[model samples]
Target: MVISPPEKPTRDEKQSAGRNVAIVALFAALGGMLYGYDTGIISGALPKMSAQWGIDHTRQEIVTAAILAGAVIGALVGGSLSKRLGRRKTIFIIACVFAVGVVACALAVDAWMMTFCRLFLGLAVGACSQIVPTYIAELAPPQRRGAMVTFFNIAIGVGIFLANLVSVVAAAGDSPEASSNWRWMIGIAVFPALVLAAAMLQLPETPRWLIENGTVGKARVVLRWMRPNRTAAVEETLQIWAISQQEDKESRGGWANLTQRWARPALIAGLGIAAFTQLSGLEMMIYYSHTILGTAAGFDAGLVVWSGLGIAAVYLIFTAVGERLVDVVGRRRLMLTLIPGSTVFLFGFGLMFVLTDHPNRYLTLALMLAYMACNAAGLQAVGWLLGSELYPLSIRDRATSLHAVALWGSNLVLTLTALSTIDGLGLGPAFVMYAGFNLLSFVFVYFAVPETKGHSLEDIEQSLRDGTFLPLRGNIASRIGLPDNRITTGAAAD
Candidate 1:
């Protein structure tokens, strides 16, 4: 009978490992920071770029839509690249591209050149949109995973706020048409991208990805690093290994697999949430903050930039609160609760336009701040994490690609058409249209989104395979005074 293998690490060893994992996750979140900076910087740069280039609304639409167009391609291809090269490597590549694109935008001689540069940057942003949430979720433990992954989104909001603040300071006491100032606003993002690339060199690949590639021993080592104790680490390693082996045996490849009954609902939920995330009018708010304040509220460039800072501050504040509460409150509940409130604000925001023959800048500002708070506390924090975690492990990356495609695709369409809609439909009606979109988003979340607060990745996969992953019937029906009709008490026929 010989000595059995050691059962546990020493307490000191466990503590050290947990500390290391946390440090790594914090660094990995830099990717989200870069994503936010690149996206947010452009919002501030656009006005000066338009001034310098003498660009019309159509060209403004093209310039803004270019990055989104690149993001669409990036989202579609990012999963495949991550599948081939691994997440950390793909992210490093994205960081490099972001650096190059940011510099290119800052130095571009014309609107067309700037548009092309943005296209390159969008590719990286789009890839980060898929990769960061997916990467964070795979590394975190179930009990704290929701909050952990949401930290990535919170980083994004912070980056956005900081980028806008920089713009405010950069433009302060300067003419609106100053050419070099926009370049500085656009170029400052390169520092974060550089930091992200440097930080990634120190992080490990996710354990599930390692196990899937036949590195079970290494996967166990990483889990031990993340978990608080021995039993938990071993148990999770077994759980991940067992599920991965089965998924490899039965999981089909490619989009065709999503047509299967067990896979369809998750795909629908993934893509629907993605599409609705953009349709929440987030891009319009962030990208066009200047335009909305100017057109509807009659604010000058200086006033608009100051108001942009206010919106960014509100966004950052609530996103932090949402990050902490995502696990405590549950994803579906948080989204369902906040979206209706955001819709109300969206309508009120539009109504301010309707009531005022001229601009009621303060009232519009109040409504915008309230809307930002609801969005940050709910949709903006929840959407990326949900899409990353909802699919089966076998097809997660591929499904994420398509889901991200829908996200950026929706973003592109909205950004391209926002000015036109405001022109064609009037600012009040345009706001009303956004309010309608927000209302539909609430209905969709109510009827379709599932709660994934405490479930492990493997448990969620098994639930999807069994057609029991969605609509949280007991909870939803209870909330609405109806029977739990959405619950699947028995197996599907297929």
Candidate 2:
């Protein structure tokens, strides 16, 4: 018997399916928010906790970097859990873990206890970062997948912005107990975690994953729910099953298989992209933005709050812009452009600090915003999207696990190193080191990374197998080979 390809949906049918996909993507985006809130909350809370806990710089680094270390463990284990428990179920479990971690941190009696609790919180954050975008990508139709996944970053920025706003307000109140204010900061995460856990019950499992696990009938049911009135649901389910089965025949889905011929290059590229993105020192800016602003620029707490908010706003806007254009501009081009641009900004930032005894404060702020904007446009928006798309379905789970581990590992090292580097070497030297990393990243992307903007997972897999990089093109569809009818015409349509 010949298996037919899935038929393309009609205009009305596409619209109907798109609406449902949007709703589910929004729900998944909440996971992104939790990841951002958990990570960014410490930025504001750290100062208050320092005075209350009487911790030194070294101890402070340990407290802040604990989550990143836990994230490495979480990312390593999260894939196996997703395979056993299902993606939606695993995410719900992670939400519970996040809530528990929040409570532990909020109620901690000492710095050591808070450090231990942060490891648990990092585990949840790490898992969500791996699972949420993959869930969104698998459920979304090819046409809108980029936009759907990009929502993760936007949600993350919103979470960071909210965390900062909350910190500013909490600190401003000058509670009778300043130590207690930090507790509120950590505890605020619990409300969102509980809400996300409850909200997930309404979501269906990925039809593709259901089919992969030998539940074709259940997969069909899920596809129907996701695509409601479309007759294409059955056909889409079958095609996904076929691709998954082909992948299964090639290798077992594990770390061992990740080294096989078909998987290795993609694994390297994915991990490299993830690592380089973190090594750009973006998180250093994020987790220590308050301190950097106050010390480097000699800004006060109020100025730090305002400047941080401004940076967050720039990230949000540029991330949205990048997400909208990712399909159009292609991933390689964006990275090629943004990485170098970021390096230049970092160089300028360091130089500004060194050259003038007291540099023009306004110029420094403008340069900082430029750095944030350029980062959001490229590394922040594109990193996860490319990482998710680079691997074949057979090893996607394991590959993403590895990628997440590398990302957080680099994050942990950078976070820990930044404290010592900033304190001992000074802010200028610390930033110069990051600037050097970005320069190396530009060369890596130019030589090793391929354009994956318009291509399907199968196409990307085939390209990797053949050692072919899809040529950069003016129109997006040319790179991915989407049928003209399937392409959205403009940014407005997207």
Candidate 3:
């Protein structure tokens, strides 16, 4: 006897399809929180630790930048490791590493010890930065992919905000707290690290990754959790399986695979966006916000830490704005607006420093808040979209690894030299330098970064291969493809 097929899902059932995905995105984004927390905690902890450890500004740079160094190493190998170990397992392992690193940092007696501890923390942060976006993309519905991925970055801002708040609270204490408060500030990350570790035990691997590993049954199971209808899930699984099979046939996934002519432009686009994102000084601003406030604005530690709270608040808010606006406004348009707008604010941020009179502390405050808001809305917001999407599926893991390496390496150079640059050229000149980078970033985005706002994965990859994808000038990507939200089972309009 023949069996009847499962009926199409009702509209409410379709709406409910994303429940599991929403839960998954929440947990996945928590790993991003660990990344944000680990990196962000240092902004507050560094000043206090520097004083207690008796390290000068130069030593602080070494200590502060060491994590970026470790992150670079982590990004370099993370892709290979994720492929071998599976994304779920790799992220679980990263969580464990983050816990150990934060605790070690808390216990450190000197800059050398803390710097070494931070290296491990950085490794976890770097790996999460590379893998989380890819993982999220694989799980998210096509129509809402940008919003889902942006969730991870928003979590990063939350981590930064929490870090700044911790600093403000610590600064309110008396003498003993001032000297060793860095320990409490840095050590708090351990809780979230552990939370993510626990969360991962319940999470499944992405359907794409599972399919790639010859576990089609497992892929189906995961897809059921991600899509609204079993019919849709089956369809999506088949689509993902087809892409995986084709990609595997096309490339073996290593440095050698990355050299293919078709792959090169996508690789360059991803890497260029990554490099430009970091070089625009977001890392420098993030890793050194409190320090910049102190040095450039001449705020005392109390004032600096308090001001940081404002910066962090604005960052969290605007990143959320960017998150909501990404799919609505289109990736390239948002970038076009954000990058150029940020340049104006960057110049304003620098101009305030140019005059030594400190004539208007309120104006300085306004300029900084504006700069932070715009940067969060712009560069910091959209930087990951290109890295997450531009590469071909066959080489995505390795390509993203390389992209992450470019990101952290650029981060390392900026963080490692930022203070020195300030020392050598002074604050006004340093801000001006960063502004120039943002100006340069505007040029790059205008000409290179394509709009992938509504394109399917297949169309996006094909466009990149055909070289029609770059320099996107409209809402829709140039393509011929299936209906929108191709991965979801919900009726195209249901």
Candidate 4:
């Protein structure tokens, strides 16, 4: 006698599962908003805080770079912390730290106190940068992974927008009392921290993490909830279990696994992309655009602060656009399409700065906006997304922490040196240097980064093991359907 397999989940059931997974991803993405808000708030607050505290350029740089320093340390320790404590718990700890750190910053009595608190706050920011996309990527199906993982990017844009809006609103007062309003800007982030902590209670541990820890039954249940149907969930569970066992036999985990021959490509791609995301000058602008515009471009202080609002608006808008484009055009194609525009726009921006002490303000604004649009849509959007997807599941936590370290460490160097560099080399030359970085980024991505869109985590790991992970002339691997792009029987597209 032959027996038919259990019936697949119905269409309604599939829809329900997808909706549930989306909700979970959205909640997790809130951590990114906290990261953005805390980091972006300083851009507007710095001018006021500097005035209020009677600080010099060196002190201001210290205050700004403090959080980045802590973020580097957070990324350094986060891999071990997340691996031992689990992703969900690590995020909860991040939320708590975010709350406490913000509160401490609000109450800081001096520049030194604020620097310490920002450093403390950066622990959450760094850890969130490492974990949120990783968590979302693990839960999302390959078909939906690009868009879903980018939700973290979208949330960060939202947070930056909110920080800028708050700054603009606070500056609208412009009274003697308004000098202290930076405290309010730094303090208001606590509510989002609270929200993220509460959301963690309802989210499940990732199926991959559970499988690695030998909780295969719970992993299957999570996959059932996260995937479209029971059959797909069961198949994925088996795949993850098999990979976990094979990896166990292959090497010891930790720094050792990352040094393996197979991991070399992912290391270069992930860490190189991470460094370029900063070296390309996005973070430098985000943190110090107001200063660059007001001091270097000779814009009015009010217009400079207001430009932060506009810059953030463009970032949010294009990041949302990139969310759709990444999945539709694929990761490699999207970046290649947008990055050249960034290089060109930045060079033009530098030319404007070189033209005169007082170049055309409107032209400068136009170039800055155009550069932001291209960078936000391309490299900035892809950097974190690639870090989350490139490594094998066995070493993903460690690899992502390294990715975050490269990102935050580069950010730290840029933050500390931006003012000094602009002062010494002239703003035009500094930006021209950034334009060169963008050009170099294009070369690196074209040669090193492979197409990862629409490929399952297990399929990517298999490619690495088989030494087939490199990109072809036009990503023929994806076009030829080498990866597991097919849906399981009775399972709907996620």
The root-mean-square deviation over C-alpha atoms between each candidate and the true structure, in angstroms, is 3.6, 4.9, 4.2, 3.5
For residues 1-494, what per-residue lDDT tens digits would candidate 2 score against the true structure?
Answer: 99987566677876777788888988888888888888988888888888787898899899999999999999988988987788899889988998999989999888999999999889998998898888888887665677889899888988888888787777677442255688878898899889889978879888767888889998887777677454667767877877777778764636677777756767776788899889998767889888788766688778887777777778778889988877887677787778878898887887787776577777887877887888888988888887777887778888888889999999999999887887787677778878899898876766556666555555566665665533333565454433222212221222
**TM-scores for the candidates:** 0.93, 0.91, 0.92, 0.94
Task: Give candidate 3's TM-score.
Answer: 0.92
Q: In order, what lDDT does every prediction score? A: 0.82, 0.80, 0.79, 0.87
lDDT tens readout by residue for model 1, 231-333: 7788889989998898886555666666768877788887888888889897568888877787656898788888988888898889888998888887877
Span of ten consecutive residues with least summed lDDT in model 3? 482-491
Compared with the true structure, what per-residue lDDT tens digits does model 4 show for residues 342-375? Answer: 9999999998778777788888898999999999
Q: Residue 390 in model 2: shift from native, Å?
A: 1.1
464: Cα error in model 3, Å: 2.6
Scanning candidate 1 in windows of ten residues, the lowest lDDT window is 485-494
Top candidate by lDDT: 4
Candidate 2 is scored at a TM of 0.91
Model 2 stretches with alpha carbons more than 4 Å out = 1-11, 175-179, 228-231, 469-494
lDDT of 3 by residue, 115-219 (tens): 898887889888888998888888888788888888888999899889888878887778732478777788878888888899989989988788889999999
Query: Using lDDT as the measure, what is the rank order of every candidate, best first?
Result: 4, 1, 2, 3
